[model samples]
Target: MRLALLSPLPPDPSRLAHHAAQFRRALNLGGIDVLTPLVGQRPLESLEAARAWVAERDWRGVDVVHAELAPGQRTVYWVLQALARLPHGPALTATVHAPPGLLGQPLHAPFAGVYHARWLPRLTRQASAWLAAPFTRHIDRRLARRLAGVLCTSDASATRLARRLGLPRERITVLPQGLPELACPPLPSGPLKLLCLSGPGQALRPLQDLVAALGQLVAQGGDDLPPWQLTLAGATAASCFEPPRHDPLTRLQADPRLKALGDRIAWQLDPDPQDLPALMAAHHLLVLPERPQPWGLGEAEPGPTAPQGACDLALAVGRPLLVAQQSGQAEQVTSGNGATYTVGDHATLLAVLQDLLTDPDRLSDWATQARRQATSRQWTQMSARYVGFFQQAVARSTRAATK
Candidate 1:
C-alpha cells in the first residue's frame, strides 16, 4: 500500500516525533512517504503555513494518509482540513497522542509565546487559549469523525477520546506503544535507582507528591529502608518555549520539601535518545506519578491526557514499575509485574516502594515478568497489527465513499 505519514520526524526531539519515526521504520512499507511539519528547525507555527505545506505535497496514489496528532498542534488541524476538502483522497487516519483539549503548557507552536512570558502577554495568551480551547476540541472531534479510524495508546485513552469525540468506541483502536529491541540486562545492584519521565509544561503536583514521599523516606531512614535515588528524565521539543523559571525541574527544586534530602534525586533532563536504553537498564524501578486531572489553571477544566511513554520505556528495559492509582501506567501493571498506590497519596507511594525494595526476590521476578510482557508487544508483532488496521481503514473508507 502507498502510505503517507505526516508528523514531526527525528532531530525534532519530541516524544511524539520519536514514536512516529519508530513506527515509520518498523512499518518499513515500500513507497511510504514521510512528510514533516517542521520548516528548518521548528514546527509550522500558523495554519496558513501548514496548509501551504500540505498543498505542496502530491498526495495522489497514496492509499492512506495518517497523521500523528496532539493538542494545540496547528499542523494536524490544517492537514485534516485539507484532507476533508479532498473530494476523493487517501483514507484519512490519525494516531491521537493525547485527547482533545488544552494542556498546562502551550502544546502548540504558536502558544509558546504565552508560556515564555512572565506577565501581561502571558495572561493575554492564556485568555486567548481559554477562548480557543473549546473550538480546538470541536475541530478535533469533527475531524476525528471524518477519518476512517483513530488510534490511542491505552484503553483508558481510547474510552476517553471516544467519549470526548462523541464517537463509537468501536471506531477507535487501542495500539500500545511498541517496545524497542533490547535485551533485559541484569538488574543493577546498589542504591535503588528509580526513574520517572515528565514532559514540558507537565503538572507540578505529581512531582511534588513524589518529592514529599521521598523526603519522608529520608527523614525516617532506617535499616529496613533501602538506599534509593530517583531520576526524573524528559525531553523538551524545539517548539516548546521554556524560560528558566518555567522549567519543570527548576520549579520542582524550588518547592519546599519537608526533609532536605541532598543528592538523593537526580535530573536527567533531555538526555540523548541513544542513551535511553542504557539509562533504563541501570534503574531498578520506573515510577509514573499520577495527574488525575489534566494540566490547567482550573482543576475543573478538562485537558488532554498524558502520554504513556514511561510505561512503554519500563517494558522496553524490563524494569518493574511503581505507578499511582490513577496513572494510565497502572493498567500495564498486572499480577507480578508491578504495583500501584492511591493518587496523591505519597504515604502509600512510600510504603509500596519500601515493600518492593525490601524484597529483592519479588523485584527480580517482576523484572522477568516485565521482559516477558515486552516480548509480546515488540514492533515485529505490532507492525503486523498496524498493517491490518490500515488495510481495514482503507476498506472502510472505500465502503463509505461508495455509500
Candidate 2:
C-alpha cells in the first residue's frame, strides 16, 4: 500500500534516523511504496516555511503516514502537528524511540520532556520548556488518539506512551527492533568478548561496572578466572550541558584495580556507526548499562523511555546481552539470551559476569539462544507484521467511516 514516512533523512546521527532507515529498508523488502516529504523548488528556509508547505499538502492518497517520535524533536513535532490538523489526511501512525533524541538532546522530566536548544540560553530554555512541556504533552496525547497505531521498540516505551497519552495498552504496540535472519556463527575460542556501546551520559555507565566486575574477578580468582576480552565503544561523555557527562573509561583506566587487569578490556573510541553490525557479529555479547526508568537529578521522570538499540543489535547479530535489569533491553534478554543486573549494583553484575566468563559451555548456550531470539524477530517476518498493523488501522478507519 502507498505510505508517506515522516522521519529525518538518514546519516543525521540520531539512532532513530537509522531506525527509520532500517524500517524503510524493511518496507522495501515487503514491496511497499513509501514516500518522504521533502523541500520543493522554492526552497523553504525555515521551520515556519516548512510547516506552511506541509499545511497545504493534499495527503489523502496515501493509506498511512508513519512518523517517528523522540522526546522534543522539533522537526518531527512540527510535521506531526501539521498532519494532526487534517481530519481527512492519511491514517496517522508513529514509532516512538525512548528518551535521548538522536542528536544527543536531553529530554527533561516526563511531564516536561523538551530538549536544550543551542539558540536559546540555558535558563531561558528551561523556563520556556517548563511552560511549554505541558502543552506539548497535551498535543502528544491528542496525537496518540488520532493515530491508528503507535509502535515502540520496547514494551517499557509502549507503557510510557500509554501513560503519557492516556491511551489503552492495546492502542500502543510493542514492535521490538527486528533484524534479518542469519545463520548462527560458531562460538569464538577463548575469553568472552564483551562489548558495550554506551556513549558517556551521566545517566548510564556499564563500563564502570565492567571495570568493577573485572577488579572483583581478578581479585577473587587472579588469572584463574576464565580469560575474556572487553571492548567498549562510545563510552565517552556524549554532552555536558543539560546533565554533566561522565567518563567511566578514563576513571576505570586510572584505578589501580583496573590497571592490574591491563589489556584485558580494549576501548573503541567513537567507532563508525556503519560498522556496528560487523562489530556486533565479532563480539560474543552486547552490554546495556542503562536503568529501565531513566532519572533526572536522582528523581525519576516517567515521561520518555531510554534507548534499546543494543537490544536490536544483539538480536541482529546473535550476540547474548548483559543488560541492566530495569532497562527496557531487559525484556529482550530472556533467561537463555543473557543476564540482567541492577544498574548501580556492582556486585550483582560481577557475579553474573563471573558465571559466564568462567564457563564456555554457558556462553555457547546463550549465544545459541541469542541467535534463536534474532531468528524469531527477523525484519522479513516483522516487516509484514508492521505493514499489517498499518493496513489493519486503515481498514478499521475505513469501516468506521462507512458505519
Q: Estimate each model's TM-score.
A: 0.76, 0.80
Tens-digit lDDT track for model 1 on 330-363? 6788747888887668678877777776878888
Stretches off by above 4 angstroms in model 2 are 10-14, 39-55, 71-73, 99-124, 180-184, 202-206, 235-244, 292-307, 344-347, 400-403
Residue pairs clashing in model 1 are none
Candidate that scores best on lDDT: 1
RMSD of 1: 5.7
Model 2 lDDT tens row, 1-403: 8888877656565555656777887887787898987412243433465568777777767888888765434566567667766767777787776432211132334323323444445465456555665665665676577777787776676777777788888877777677756656766666678877665443534556667777777788786776778786653444333433455555555767666777886777656656777777888877777654333322222211123555676677788888877566677875488888886687888787888866777878888888778787887777787877888778866765567
State in Å the error of residue 1, model 1.
Answer: 1.4
TM-score of 1: 0.76
Q: For candidate 2, what is the total of clashing residue pairs?
A: 6
